[model samples]
Target: MKILVTGANGFIGSNFCKFLVSQQIFPRVFIRKNCDMSLFKQLVPEWKQLEYVYGDLRDKSSIRPAVRGVEYIFHIAGTIKGSSWIEFYEGNCLGTLNLIKICEEENPDIKRLVFTSSMVAGGPGTPESPQCEDTPSKPLENDWYGISKYYTECCSKKQTNKLPIVIIRPPMVIGPGDKISFDLFNIAKIGIKVFVSGTPRQFSMVHVEDLVKGIFLCGTHPKAIGETFNFAYDGTISYRDLHEVIATKLFHRKYGNLIPIPIPPPLFYFVGLILELVSKISHEPPFLNRPKAIQASASGQTMSNQKAKQILGWKPKFSKISALEHAGRWYQQQKWL
Candidate 1:
């Protein structure tokens, strides 16, 4: 059972690859040339268990060898942030289409091609009313990342007949070895928590471990073929409650007083604009960009886990707070905190 994991150096992808190694299956990992492997290396000590294949998803020649003869292709690589809409499109949509064509032409007999879609792809929902797989995608115009992923899903679905494709849309994924949440932990260490909105923001999320297990099921399950499911946990968490959880549950010790500061939208966006200016020059996405700020200030952004639970018989082992506790401990274990 040959398997190829694209974006294997990423948080979820790397963790899934590690899980595969535990099952005594050394999956082939497709990585970018000269990409950072520090996190992936740190997670997997017996790194030799993975067959590393360096290439770009956009490069056909580079990916042909990686796509050839693999039974399962975990298409987890996609742009999370970018300087512009085109950058997101190239990274998410074009690259995915490229992989799909290569799979069709080079290895049509592949058992499954599992895509990691974002929950935002089918959004315009709140915590009180979450989006399910049956709901139509209503990606916001300001969010290029979400739109790109939706476009990729649209493109991939067209080729489902040609290639076995299973799309799993994951909510805000939080867990061990996540590089994105480093800033939150760092801020927590400084004994401060800030928010732009007075009303707490509720969100749906899943631990990486649970999400990876779901992805595995998607790759192997016959029912999941040509289907889409949301791989989110069965509940929601707010930023304020999350801070409390981090302080009390993350350390499991007497943590320092975390000062909660609430600022107006104007002030927050002012700071975000400054960061965006700096990011423009750095070619890195600003942490508090327009779309991100919208998400931060919104009331709720949630996805339903009913489809995953009913179809895959999958439920998250760790609750929202417990998941954060586990992730925070790992960050400390690796000195990321």
Candidate 2:
């Protein structure tokens, strides 16, 4: 099958590319002109048939050729961090809209467009109830990334009749090439864990391996067309539980137990302010900014993969703990630890 994969160098997309190659499907990967080739080269498996189309999604001229002859399109390119709402809207919302418009003009009969969306778009969840596909989306206030993604999802759904599209929302994805997980795992390696002072927040997570499988199902499964599915480990776990899992279950090192450091929301914002200031000088957004600080202090964010399991008959092969172990090994192998 002719397939086109966007964001092929990113954490989840890189894993999807590898999965495609393993299945003997060589997809044409769409990359930006200024994308980091080093990380892309290291993460994406090489194959003689593997091809690349260098272009930016916002530029219609560049994206047309990438979608012209492809049977399936994996629209995974998006910005998780942005300096403002417009920046997020341009990359996450407008970019998808542009691709949709171009695809309608170029390849009207395309098989499917599988979009990798974030559970953040569906808003934070509580441990009492994990977020489901049917959940009414309520993205955090001032969270540009989440708001933009939510709008994108809404826009994509509107074009369902013209383009076969499937939306897959992933919660706290963990695997190789993930920067946030590296930070979390790396800090855990030092026998310390951070927690905000409040009710322990819950989380839903998926290994990149299983997330790619869900994405594949969304692309090819008949029932997945014109639908949105959240792919994650079955249920939610508290951050406390997650912290223990990483340090005890994965590390199994001396240090006895990880020292828990509880910080207030105000302190998190203080740190975020400092990082934001640093970002001004560096021109690179810090992982923890004001909006991120809001997210960090927010309630548990969880999701349910039941729809994918039932409709696509897809079952996750890795639990959160097992996934962390796998990610840990990969980090060591990549010398990213």
Candidate 3:
């Protein structure tokens, strides 16, 4: 099968490419001209079998050649961290629309266009009540990332009649080569557990490997056409519990010695405000900002994966503890801890 994997140099995308190679499937990879190829180089050593297409999601003209004549297109390219909402919209919303347009015009033979959306796009559910595909999106006005992803989902649905498309919404993905989870591991390595507030926030997560498998299933499963599936583990974990797991895996000790520090919600908001101001002056995005602060302060953010399992025969292979241990081992090997 001819396949095109966009954003193949990113964390999940790179891992997906690696999975394809392991399965003896050589796929054409579409990547930005300025993307960092470090992860790709480390994961995929058999570059001779793979085809590379250089393009940007922002440029409509560049996407045509990449999408043309491909049986499947895994559209995973999007801006995850940005200095402003415009950047996220340009890359996630407008970029998705441009890709759909090119697929319609240039790739009529495409069997499936698997889109990678986020669970945040569907917004959050209460800790007691996990969200499902049927849940309505209540994205916060300040959560630009979620807004952009939600818009992308809407664009994909609008194009479903014109083209074959399947959307997979993955929750917080954890595994090797993941910088987002690595931050938490780094913090835990220092024996400090930082909480945004006294209130506990719940989150659902999936391992990168399992998420890639789910994406592959979405592309291949006949029943997945014109449908959206949430790809997450079976259950949710509190933020404090997640931190404790990371600390346990890293320190190999109980959580008693770990310092639990709580930052008031107001102080967290102030920090975000200060970072936003500095970002404006320096023209560089701060590691923490208003949108991130708002998300961190929110209490509930969980999702259900029953749809994916029932419809696509997909289930996560790693439990939370196993996933954390695997990530911790990788960090230790890389000396990231």
Candidate 4:
């Protein structure tokens, strides 16, 4: 079956394309004008079977050609930068709208559209709580990234009717080639000690490969259509255990001096402002952006993925340490650390 994958060069998209190719299926990729395809080249060497199209999700005319005659469209492309939320709306909300329009006009015969949504929309500190597929997302979610994803879901539900559409809400997706998790790895490698909030907060995570498997099944699984599936591990990890895992791997020994001091959110913002000013002058990003870190840490985040396993028969294979080890090795190979 022919399929179209947007952002095929991104971390998750590239991984999913590679998975499909390994299964002997060729999937066409739609990319934007300025996106670098070098990531695709290094990761997926069997490019002859992979079709490439240049289009912008913000432009209706540009998206039409890519949607033609495809059986499935995995809409995995979206913005995730914590700073500057306007870009998120344009890329995530408006971009999805354009693709949905194209699907209606060009590929009305498409089998399904599988959208990758974020778990942040469910709110922070959600572990130890039973979150079902039909739970209404708390409207008080503060993060801009989550807000953009929530709106994307709204737009998709409104405009989509030609084909069955399934939403995959994944938690802290972990695997190789992830820059966000690389931050934690880097700190461990350098033997730097830091403080973590001393609370028994659970964090949900999924291997990239497992997430890919879920996405592939979502396209064809009849039971998955029009359903929202949480694609996370069945279990959760605490902040203390998470830090210990990284420290042990990086330091070759157990180490902990974590100060659990809950600084006021406003004080955190004050520090962020100074860091932002310095970053602007130095032409470099701050270690932690004020708004993003405050939101992520302050609001505990976790979820359950029972629906994905039950509906799609998807099982994740990587543990937290295994994921960290794979990411560390990749960083060493790429000299990214």
Model 4 misses residue 173 by how many Å?
A: 1.6
lDDT of 1 by residue, 1-337 (tens): 7999999888888799888877878889999989878778877777876788898988988989998878999999988866579988999999999999988889989999999998878865577788889888888767777889999999999998888899999887877777666666666666677677677778888899999999999998879999999987777877666666687776553543678877676677577667668877886445566556656665568888898988888877888878888888888888877
Of 1 and 3, the candidate ahead on lDDT is 3
- lDDT value, residue 15 of candidate 1: 90
Q: Candidate 1's error at 335, in angstroms?
A: 2.1
Measured with C-alpha atoms, the lDDT of residue 48 in candidate 4 is: 67
Taken over the whole model, the C-alpha lDDT of each candidate is 0.82, 0.83, 0.84, 0.74
Q: List runs of model 1 lying over 4 Å from the truth.
A: 251-257, 265-270, 276-287
For model 2, residues 29-137, the per-residue Cα lDDT tens digits are 8989887665556655474468889988888889988998999999999887766788888889988999999999999999999988889899888767778888799
lDDT tens digits, residue span 295-318, model 3: 777767788888999999997899
Worst 10 residues of 4 by lDDT: 256-265
Write the candidate numbers in order of decreasing lDDT. 3, 2, 1, 4
Off by over 4 Å in 3: 272-288
lDDT of 4 by residue, 1-337 (tens): 8899998988899889989999999998999887766767776889767888888889889888899988999999987653567877887888988888778888877889999988766556465574556778753345666788888887777655555888888877766667666666666656653333444556777778888999998998889888888877766775556656766765465556433344455665666667667767875445545544554464456677777878788877776667666666777789876
Q: Show the colliding residue pairs in model 2.
A: none
